[model samples]
Target: MGKKFFEESELIINADGSIFHLHIKPEQLAHKIILVGDPGRVSLVASHFNEIESEVESREFRSITGRYNNKRITVTSTGIGCDNIDIVMNEIDALANIDFNSRQEKENFTELEIVRIGTCGGLQPHTPIGTYICSEKSIGFDGLLNFYAGRNAVCDLKLERALLNHLGWSGNMCAPAPYAINSDKELADRISGNDMIKGITVACGGFFGPQGRQLRLPLADPNQNEKIESFRYDGMCITNFEMESSALAGLARLMGHKATTVCMVIANRYAKEANTGYKNKIDDLITKVLDRI
Candidate 1:
């Protein structure tokens, strides 16, 4: 069978031959990529690079390619949600394996090693503020991966069933079904340390209702956070809540790439504590990832 061609609307390339949303050319990318949520953090990651080869900025997506410890790496910002993660993951894969000029798949494949470094609100007591949490697996409350075909092929079905049963999620609540995806074990282990807590992470769709943070509006399940905190499967408990990770790990798995997320705990939902001055902690985390990746 012949390869299918990607439609112009589906695979958008700028006139300058760069990816549409990210505004990054294929050559500017690196096999080792670090994803950050805030665009401002891209520069911080690049600062540790010995030599920066290229930098591109468009919309909330900012990219920088450089060398860290003689290994070429690219640091890019993905804004703040799984929706954005959908865009970033697909385009990054396309850049690595698609022929933009022909809009077709390349004969050879280029597998990427992607790592997401972000801040999260810790759910477990052990994951208090200033702690580092490496997501061995991510629970997707975002439902971004559900839209794609073969989602279950890349997901953890047993874990998903356990989570759904624990949450008592029904169709009537208009809640998105939760899914689970394990991180690339090699990548997760590489970025983890004795001080880091390796556990399940929740990738939420929204900040308020999705994460049990009530403000002006009321949540359908007021005890949602409590239930989530108590839930466990195969001795793995959900460690923290973040905006990305599930989609990154899911899409990367489906695309035959290595992906994982490691986050710094800036807030503890269990302890009701937050560290607003988390810059130093994140800097330390970045250095750890750079050295390991």
Candidate 2:
């Protein structure tokens, strides 16, 4: 029997033969990719490149392929949230592993090395503003991975159940069941350091109610943050909150790629501290990732 092919509707290639959402041709993709939440950050990362080979921009997705320290790298913006991550990770893997013309999976695919450098809110006192937290594991409140098959193969069931029990999770709560996935150990080791605090990061679905922020609308569980912050598993405590790391790590694991996240702390939820002037810190983080990645 012939190999099963991806349907046109499912694996979309633009008329110009580029990935649908990312708008990047397969050839334009590099083996190494750095993911950032802001589209403007694309240029920031590319600035460090010795020379750029290509640049593509469409909607919130901006991509630039260039050389850093003589090594080829592609930096792409994912905008924000796990929803955007779903589009970015799939299209990225398709670019590396799927044959656009044949619409078939490549027999031997290139495994991508992906690192996400972003800004996040610190959940713990130790993870203060200006701290760099390497995500050893990401807890997903986004409920994204539950939709995908074989998620259990990549997720940490023990961590999931532990969190569920700690929070007394129930289907009636109208919240997604939390899931956990670890970063690529080798990649994490390369990008992390003594200066960076390594811990579990919670990736929330929204910036408001989902993250325990109050405006006019009240939170379903006002104490959700307290419960999350106090929960402990395998000697690791929740350290930070971000929007993208969970989906980035979970999807990459399923796609056989190496992925991890290192975020600079811009706000401390516990301490009620925030640093609006975090661009310089982000630049320092970019330098660290560019050098180590």
Candidate 3:
């Protein structure tokens, strides 16, 4: 078969053969990547590295590769939302599996172990502030996955239908049809510790209206949080609300990579509790994830 060609517009690469958005080459990355929402958190995670190898930043995406406990790992900041995930995941996959010179896919695929460490808001009252939670399943309110073909093949249709029915969603409550995807079982098991809470996580598109936070503008569904909190399907309930996990897990699965999310609870919506002093808790969570990963 003839080698496939990618147009410059389609597969954009710098003159140095690095990916356009990330501004990083394949060699600068590790097989295991820790994705954070805040760029500053990249440095926080890399601070524990025994030896720092490389650090690169472009826009909101900051990547640092180093060795920790004799294990090579890369920590990259993905900004926020599935929009950034769309870019970051595709570029990371390209760097690992595509040859920039020929603009062709490699014969052998490189599977990545991606773990997202971020802050989240607990939806259930029982989930206390400063608690750590690992997502067994991520439900996305964003439509990024729907844009891609074969998304249904990767999603949990039964769970998705149940949630949709529970919400009474008829294309008016939200724009995108919600879908659920499970985390990599091995990574989930490895990342979950005795203290970590495991449950379904809802990835909202926005921080305010989408997450049921009231501001100057009225929300389309003010009871959104209540509905999400009360939603249960076959013993699975939504435990927390975050912005990125769904796309991360979904895209990782579609790209043949293993992925999971471990988040620190900074706020509890049901209890109306917010922790202003959670830095130390985050530090401890980071340490725990680093040790396990």
Candidate 4:
């Protein structure tokens, strides 16, 4: 056989049939996807997959595609933040779209459903830690896609302007913050009763200093997290705080795909979530969500 083009190869796969970062090929991926930020969590996710099929590991991205409820789904790691999410999300889409021989888009594309099974600090205290919460809405405090659309279009113009005014926010940066996007209904229904808490709010952090966190230095806004929780628009409170949900939601909607997230509350702004070591507890949550998802 002669040399193959990019589409002929999984870019992520080797001619020797070794997997790339995820180290798995087309057969390893399922129509449904589950994403986590940590590589270690990938094993936790894969442990739940039924009818063990295949596995791959590259860099921080660990992936396993197998059967769950007889449904084929791929579980992988996104590393961290929107940049990583953007990369993994696109690659997964490409795997299903392109011919794996030529890099060209397929004549008929498949819109794979994705669910981010990660951990986050929830703004709503009622959202207890260890609970698997789904993100019906996502708001980026990180400002990733701030320039993509009109500021007044998605959310309340009055609130945005009001917050700006109250903060005395004058701008060299007047770009619009990303808006909320709901997850896939079909997928959501499938996993609805599966140890999952639906309707979570995801917060994207601008950085350490601003997300109500101070390490060696002082913080810019001590009450920022509270402000996020305090604001209730249309009874939809910011459910949880993370770095990628809003961007994922918005981008998924724009791409004509359905995306949703179920996150474990690593920390709750309010003193409600059972006080336990963050790491191990989050592990339990991830397992629960994946089994149900």
TM-scores, all candidates, are 0.98, 0.98, 0.97, 0.78
Query: What ranges in model 3 sit over 4 Å off?
Result: 171-174
Q: What is the lDDT of candidate 1?
A: 0.93
Candidate 3 lDDT, tens digit per residue, 1-293?
A: 88778789999999887899999998998998999999999999999999999999999999999999988999999998989988999999999998888888988989999999999999887688987899999999997788888899999999988887777786665456987999999899999967899999999999988999998999887887898899988887899999999999999988999999999999999998888787666878888888988
Model 2, clash count? 0
Going through the candidates in the order shown, the clash numbers are 0, 0, 0, 16
Q: What digit string (tens of lDDT, one per residue) describes model 2 on residues 130-226?
A: 9999999999999999999999998999999889888878555666788899999999998996678899999999998998999999888899999
Better of 2 and 4 by lDDT: 2
lDDT leaderboard ranking: 2, 1, 3, 4
lDDT of 1 by residue, 125-222 (tens): 89989999999999899888888889988889988887777788755467678889999999999899676889999999999899999999999999
The worst-scoring run of ten residues by lDDT in candidate 3 lies at 167-176
lDDT of 1 at 251: 90
Candidate 3: lDDT of 141?
Answer: 93
In model 4, the runs with Cα more than 4 Å from the true position are: 1-24, 146-178, 189-197, 272-292
Q: Give the alpha carbon lDDT tens digit for every residue of 13-120 in model 4.
A: 567554345555655677778888888877776776667787777888888777777778788888878877766766776567656655556778688777887777
Residue 148 deviation, candidate 2, in Å? Answer: 0.8
What residue pairs are clashing in model 1?
none
lDDT of 4: 0.66
